[model samples]
Target chain A: MMQQEEKLRVSTEQLEGGLGLVAAAGYINNEGGQAIADAVNELVASGCRTILIDLEGTRIINSIGISILLEILDRLMESGGTMAFCNLTPTIARTFEIMGLVQYARIFPDRAAALAALGRDG
Target chain B: MEVALTLPLVPDVELIAARAVQVMGRSLGMTDGELESVTVATVEACLNAMEHGGQTCFFVRVNTHREDGGPSLEVEIEDHGVGFDPQAPPRTSPSRILGCVAKRGWGLTLIRELMDEVDVRSRPGKTVVRMVKHVGGA
Candidate 1:
């Protein structure tokens, strides 16, 4: 069996009000999930308290990916930080709801809305 | 149309199964939502098979069929693993919900929710999960 290359891309930007934006694309399996965790940790290390993930380009995620997100959520909770998700595909939004991640993280329809809800200037 | 693939029990290979479902679903004229559900369900099924199937290789087969009402997509994932009872209490949604914070055990639940029909058959040496989604909502 040929190894399928990991395709998830993660990038972060610091926004006003100490909000950090992490954008991800591609499949969020094990490799993609690890990449996301690393990105969130990096942002947190830089003193960003609130984070919003833009998942507009992400289409598919497995249970492992969800686990990674949960880890990030736990980390944020420990530090009195918050995380939000924006631009979730219909399926992904439903998955998050089912997994109960929505209880801990906020989800918005778009980046602007998420940033606004997080009290950051869009 | 019909397609079959044999993949190693590995996490990254889930992409191949997902892409196959996507392409076949498009060719079968599935709506975007329907296609997305099928693809996700397929990948979830593959992931489960890889993690729990306890086998080195698993098989995925996809086919389109015309039922009495409309066309439907069917996918089957099979593996030679130490199969568990589908009727087991741990498979219930309540148990899964309780364990949500653990970030695991949602694969089977997600597959059941996303697919129109699901069937699981398991024995000591083999396990097979078959799922179907009807097109056109007939």
Candidate 2:
């Protein structure tokens, strides 16, 4: 048994034109994934149609975490919302590609780029 | 270099082994993308074992040494449980169309894609996933 805080820190920000940003930092393990999923789900449930997840501070992520993201992506689509990601590590970006995630959710270089893609320059 | 640990099947137990992956990789000169790749693949292997092992605990072993090409690290996770057929294809894929997402089954896929080499041996009563990542630029 080991005592460690493999916690995921999550925050939400409202951007222009109904775009919501959910930023997550830390390992996206099972617990961390759930926390992020919950945050995004809340945004979707709150009538937000566009969302971006920032992974700047995250260095490690597993399939459980990816699966959670895919679930949230599905949820967003089902509700006519959109999901995108920014600040992904090269490894994560490759993983998303291999797992066919990028085919569905768009990936931008960073938050600013993602915002610009959504036409939210302000 | 070599290290091994057994984890009791608990929630987020993979973190313990993930720490081992990091410590070993950094100590053995793995950096940046390769280190991150190995760490994540290790976590995915541990998660697969814990999810399907049907056992109280699972094992993780890390070893690093010079290979024919260069230095490399391999992480092996083992569990004694109801193993599945290794020949069977892993069920994973994000649907191109909206409203359809296969949320699960990406663990094995990610491991195979991230690591330089991957081998999974499984059957009833035991399962082992070995993932190898080459050090330095590859």
Candidate 3:
């Protein structure tokens, strides 16, 4: 088999309270990391802190993907912002816990709950 | 459309993994988290290929097929590298994976847990991993 890498699609919605709800759906592997990093970076550039990543539509994520999330978390923290993850399945949630990601990012059951925890609804 | 990707073994692994997940998930109707799982597991497998396979060029190929009588998706990611025994020993806990931090070991454990089916073939020259996940079900 030959090696292949590609990015599918990413978009974000502006929620209330300056919170940006970014939903990145697709694969995240060695090949697909840059696009994701760029997506998160785009959110930061828009001056929207308090980011919520909806993993409900996401199917895969590699270490590089984790690095991107970590970087985003760092970016948010540096700017006095926050990041939360929602729609975590058993498998995905376990991966986050094992990687010590839960130490940095908060996990929610879904998007509405995450937003509510952010103290807003939009 | 089934796409194959090849990149030089380098430090930028996650970027590639995300791209693959995008393609597979969109085509198969997988949710965001599911795509994340595939990308993460694929990254682990690719890292193993580069490190253990001892190959200059790493290969990642994905093939998607629908279930015959069910509503689900199956994707297989195969690599061309030296493979290892998947059944060697279960790491027992995720902490062991974090504590050791070995590229191949941790990723393998995570991949096994994330995907419905994880298969590894570690021959001398060609190491392939066939991973399958079912969608649209509880």
Q: Rate the local accuracy (lDDT) of all candidates.
A: 0.82, 0.83, 0.65
Q: Which 10-residue window in model 3 chain B sums to the lowest lDDT? A: B95-104
lDDT of 1 by residue, A1-122 (tens): 32333378899998777789999988888778899888888998998888899998888888778878887888788788888999998889877876778888889999878877788432
Where does candidate 1 stray beyond 4 Å?
A: A1-6, A120-122, B89-100
> Which pairs in model 2 have colliding backbones?
none
Candidate 1 has a TM-score of: 0.91
Residue range with the least summed lDDT across 10 consecutive positions in model 1 chain B: B90-99
**DockQ rank order:** 2, 1, 3
Query: Which candidate, 1 or 3, has the higher TM-score?
Result: 1
What does the lDDT read for residue A100 in candidate 1?
70
Q: Flag regions of model 3 displaced more than 4 Å.
A: A1-6, A30-32, A120-122, B1-43, B56-138
Per-residue lDDT for A3 in model 1? 34
Off by over 4 Å in 2: A1-5, A120-122
**What are the models' TM-scores?**
0.91, 0.91, 0.55
Question: What lDDT score goes with residue A89 in model 2?
Answer: 95
